[model samples]
Target: MRSDLSRRRFLGGALALGATATLAACGYQEDTGGSGTSQAWSYTDDRGRKLGGDRPKRIVAQVTAAAALWEFGIRPVGIFGPSKLPNGEKDPLAGPIDLGKVQSLGNVWGEFNYDRYVSLEPDLLISVMYLRDELWYVPAEQAEAVEKAAPTLGVDLAGVSMPDGIEKFRTLAKALGADVNTPRINEAKATFERAGQNFADAAKTVNGKTALLVSATKEGMWAGNAQGFPSSKQMAEAGLTFLEPKAPGDGNYWEQLSWENAGKYRSDIILLDNRHGNLQSEQLKASYPTWRQLPAVRAGNVFAWNPETPFYYEAATEQLDRLGSSLRTV
Candidate 1:
């Protein structure tokens, strides 16, 4: 059996904690200054696990979680996971996190440092759970020790529509004391709302069109199941057709295929995974003749897809708009 690594050959399947009453705040930002260190704070994660304390001020979240919180104006003190690239620049999945201000515990898979994590004296550790109750990026070997170090939280990012996933983060951001009611957040939310209808309308123009979303490795390809990912689920719900594999592989997230079988499913457009370390459409063309022969590739109907896009309204709006524009060209 193949090991279940989050990156490379293994697709990841994916958290919460503490003591106080569950906060009633939803997605909107309340007038709370977000500095409620004196007031008790509690939040129930997607796994139904609740953790709380004096509104966490020294939070440590996985890079993606940090990015989502940053969008809502709550900066985590420390972050782990794929926050930095080999180039040392911030990864797109990191959103606009100021690397200089935050400490990165690990930049690659299976690289979390226990000593570094505990040294931060974190009040809360939050990460996205791609699978039920499994916190992404927390090394399984060290999970027990890490969980004992601080209160933990997990935001479910899978098996839910994009809007629903984003709302989950939004509510967590609000509960954490983000200045969500400000004009900036309101404008962002308004723009994101408009993009939803725009995406649906654009889907109408590209009638009979289809898209295939895939992430590749030197060994093979993994075509994602639209229903398994948040963005794809939302796009499909908007009436855009995404090709699904007849048989899904690990985690029900994607179908594993050798390079020779990559053309099994053909589509009008191909949304290639654009996460750091993943091969781009151009690279795929250069590396494989099969990729070159695909109709989508020949027509250049390939687009970059950041599968782990942070749950920020503006970021989501941009993502939907870009995909919508691509759908029109098909």
Candidate 2:
């Protein structure tokens, strides 16, 4: 069986703490504080080169960047290597402006069709996830190379240490021409704030339940840590506590547990990380009859948390949306 537990950590970029709380205060600003009418939009990347001027019209987003771009009201003309849907659909954007309509720009993952992407004539292209090491693990250089083909702006949130969702959205929006100060932007921000507060309130009320956030692939299972990984954090915030090991080691790691050992943890809740294709629900039920008999599953507390949603994938924005939706039934 192919294991989904990749040895390499996925670069999810920098998450600013209390990010949602401070977003309304963040906005597009000129480095030198130029006049609003300067007609020159200037911003800098990590390398310090000035960027911005003409906003992107036809945008192409691959990976988590789509979530951030979506928040900015900048829908892409195309997407690369999209996550599958529960219904077994590819490029879920098919009905309106299907992936069929967009040109395929080969991905950094080798899944993308390079020739096709260049033919699309996009105004801007963005990449979110990190490529494997042979690909240099440098999302920025790859983006710059693509920009040589079309003005591209690449942002990989896996580690810059920026604020979480709210701050991520604000920074991304301004970069993409979306106004952080606008009423619409504020409205989106407020909606996220309310959702976050709701989770916090719920967490406080449900305080003693022991939970585990597990991502199962053919590879194995991964347990999330305390810092972020939204679902686990939000669940805790909503009153559900995780029975995380005192020494989880580092980051998200799979805790291999056989049928006999599965019940030892005695969790009050189990949040399954069901990605695009998850048939484990039934398989697990058959293999671990005791697990099915566990109080959480028996009480319908075992929930499948699909991280394929736009928000979860991007981690750039709408995290509260992801958090809200994940805890809906729990």
Candidate 3:
């Protein structure tokens, strides 16, 4: 959670910029849908630069990036980042990726295991970029070391809408030889399309209700900026009117407020950041006097919100279904 806020390195200034499907690692297979031959593999990431190799068979990726590719059928040999829960259960964001088979280089912030990474004999490394040049979980100090070990591919998840983010991953998966057009993947995509409309329809039904997205703390609250986040940006554009926070400070994605000033933004509903580390909504409402005063909290209109990174269609569909169902209720 916020304890490692420094590692968040989220959208600053201009702001940067799925589904569950089984992505089983079948041991670096052939790319029927990609790689025109010669055994040489190359992928041009969001940065518009080429990261190529001998049609990379052994790949390692950030957890979320693995989630996206897994659905499309491109399995990584290893993964890093928040790959599992504190309780040792796999993070749901991991989707259906079986962590038992994939080597985990690190499971927390600032914990990239360089030696273990080299031990895997990785051919390519993949991760999503939150800021233009910042790879989500690759520690800055180890960037050079990691890059030297294997060609790293970074896909930008910021400064773009959710659909764009999802498509970018699909593109990457295709380059890696995943047949995204498969029946299962196509069904998931179709479900996502329907989910988008479902949310739009729900937004219309709850026409004027304003939803405020936030992360609460004893000190105060950090309000989310819709435009700076892909999922929220797509939702906002679809008619889920979110309270737009002014003056986004150094963290271009959030507006920090003290407990005394928490009332600056009022909403008919609140989307609480449900990521680990933050006090849950009910807990905050019961313990923090300032939190209890918020109109949405007192009205019991709080719902969970997560950034939803790496870009998968199935996960996006699930998130949309939950948000739409919640909005229609409140």
Candidate 4:
């Protein structure tokens, strides 16, 4: 599921970057790059409604976006899933809302309760995706349903990876009343930009070498071919070469790569995307234990796939910013 999510972001980037560059480009440049205050923060829902007020007080956020809100002092009245909350959610607005008091809008792949949402009487309804990437993570119909109940603000953050996700988060923050256009935003942007540059520089030093992003699970193993996970795309974007597998058109971008075949790829780096499963969990520590057994792991070139952002919200941009910092440390 995580692999598919990244793939979606890369594939969608072609369209999203073009169609909403004006919006997406926010907090990414000095002077707002001529977008101006007219292009100020606002929620662009699935239905294309623009939602903003002088001060947005009541909010209903999706799980990931809800986390972003916590980062910026905006407490959501409700969220999509209970498990989406961070560790301290129960104690305060720092995490997920109280399950008993807050209604379970829906699961990661289900519909939200429209009637209950209306009862909650939120000023704005938000959609966040840090947990799941697929649109089905929360039924598309639910977005529309919530819109009907109130001023639903659906930030379709599905498949938004790393730095891009962080940019999206800043935009969401501004819409929710954070001073995203302030010097703080600029500092954050500078930090993230430097991180990307460092990643790019490192990739260049390893010039012309290829890398692979794969995950091991109890079920088995999954490897990204071309048109797959954004992690692979990210490495490629950072300037490292990739021996992309021939994935059939937009179908399943991922295909199984046996460990034997995996070694044959001759990748300079191996990014292991650990997951929950017997085989994958075991593989996490046991798959490549011996130093001389595998070259990349032996050379300390193997990297664990680290999630940079909250995968599911407006503050995803902040998460992306963190990605650069995290990857730099790695």
Candidate 5:
């Protein structure tokens, strides 16, 4: 079960000038080189860059970004991200997009096939950016090549409120021809707003109980930093008090701790990373006597969490509903 969530950790390098020239030589160009499409369309991306050209028809995007667009009736021609589960389960981040309709460039980070991507003749490339790193979800090593292949737009996953991020996606989708006024689309948005209010109301009823989000592996446990994650911040806004590490170990997103020290934090509820499965947490509890001693763990107040969950309205509603239910029981 844990196999699906084991991502390859790679150190990204700075973009090189030589790579840019090589991409240009391969016939890759920006949106400025008109492809004979309509010129009345333009979009300002999360990076504040204005991209203009005929509405992009052949779009390539990161899987999560693709998910957000799909909710608004926009679909990408190509997507890249983690592969299906070992048992061939669909990735939740894929959202409502049918995987069979799009091309999968590669599954792992830093492993995109440049030749294949270029062959697709994409008019635009979209990805989520980690603001602090100043890098898009596209591996830094492959950034230049991907950018050269088409005009690139990034959606910031940090440095903004979750609602802001979702709005950005909506704005882009509208610019790309999605009908934002459609009943279906409006209904999804309305549902999410109500879910958020429900979560907040439920949280207020819990009497200030605290929750901790964590990811566990055979190597160790990692506590999520609410300050670094938009979803966590949104949950905080909904009245959930997330535990912040006194000393974060991995940038501002996570704090590493051994199983022996996992019980140091006292949380009323535990939100475990469920992207892979819940087997890891069970194994940890069986291996370490202290692991089961956590207040949340002992009380069985554990809930599933996916840090990379899609920011679309439907997905947001589902997640908030789950959290609201847990808060009510608390």
Candidate 6:
């Protein structure tokens, strides 16, 4: 419970709408002169805040945002989040960027180096937002300083459909001078579309088989709310049948269930949270007798999942393909 409580403390917070309002009222400088010499960029973020200024060359972004931008040829000068694995391996979410070239301000949640962030002189800051909570990756305590440093933009990952979210990132990248029509970029998009089809076909084959997405901590197990998580919603749309908890807990993201009652929902396949330190579903089964009794665990049908995975086409395609394969076999 200590770990879960600490995670909630680090990731949970009320939006500083007052700060957002103040920043919005200040108004951004629009390059109306139409100077042909220097290109100007403007974008309306998910929060409906208009952000306009000279094209940003030095950007600071959350790990997933940075990865999306990297695919579009816009590299951030600094990135923050869990960028490395327990074995010091680069996180898959950060796969598009050369970590050696970027400044790592902080690698864990709630850890930010003000001095290093300021030194980067970023023109823009980007992160993902969970619409229900209106909280972005940036912590509430650091919001003011971070906003002061540069115009902040949030990709509304949870508010819209997954495809729409990906398109928004593409639009932002295009505004930032990305060549969206490049052969490589187009190939990635096509690949993603094919992966989506594959996933749907796989799910269709499964028919009545059900999947459960859950995260296990020492205190208990939490089931993912299909309606709350964009990825889970996408899977459901693609034909995957996810069991919804009878009683969704706080925020509609998860249902807290004690380990003893972990078998409450019988699932043919289990998607285990694989972010950084969370135990793999197999490991959980090995540790908890009750968890071992689950049909999915007993049948060895568990797959890893990263709830905060990058929304870029390439990453999304890979993840979907993995799930599709898992479904086809399970």
**TM-score for each candidate, following the candidate numbering:** 0.87, 0.66, 0.88, 0.62, 0.87, 0.89
Error of 1 at 103 (Å): 1.1
Per-residue accuracy of model 5 over 1-330 as CA lDDT, tens digit each: 111224532123333333544534533335454556645567766655566757788888888788889888888988887646667777787777788998888776556777878888898888877643334447667776666667777777764556767888898899988887799988888888898889889989876788998888766677877766667688887778988888764445677787778876789888887776434567767886777889998888888877776878888788889878987887
RMSD in Å for all candidates = 5.7, 8.1, 6.9, 8.6, 4.1, 3.5
The candidate that wins on TM-score is 6
Q: What is the lDDT of residue 211 in candidate 5?
A: 90
Ten consecutive residues with minimal summed lDDT in candidate 1?
Answer: 21-30
Q: lDDT for each of the candidates?
A: 0.78, 0.50, 0.76, 0.49, 0.73, 0.76
Ten residues in sequence with the least summed lDDT for candidate 3: 17-26
- What lDDT tens digits, residue by residue, belong to model 4 across residues 1-330? 434342122222111111233323322223232444654344554435454334456677766567655545467777764333334334222142344545557543455676777787776666643222232234544543443445545554434445565466666776666776556556655665665666676665667555665655433345555324444445567676666655422334445554545454556666665322213323545653332354555555666553222432333333334433434433
Clashes of each: 5, 23, 12, 25, 0, 0
Best by lDDT: 1
What TM value does model 2 have? 0.66
lDDT of 4: 0.49
lDDT comparing candidate 3 with the true structure? 0.76
* Candidate 1 lDDT: 0.78
> Higher lDDT: candidate 4 or 6?
6
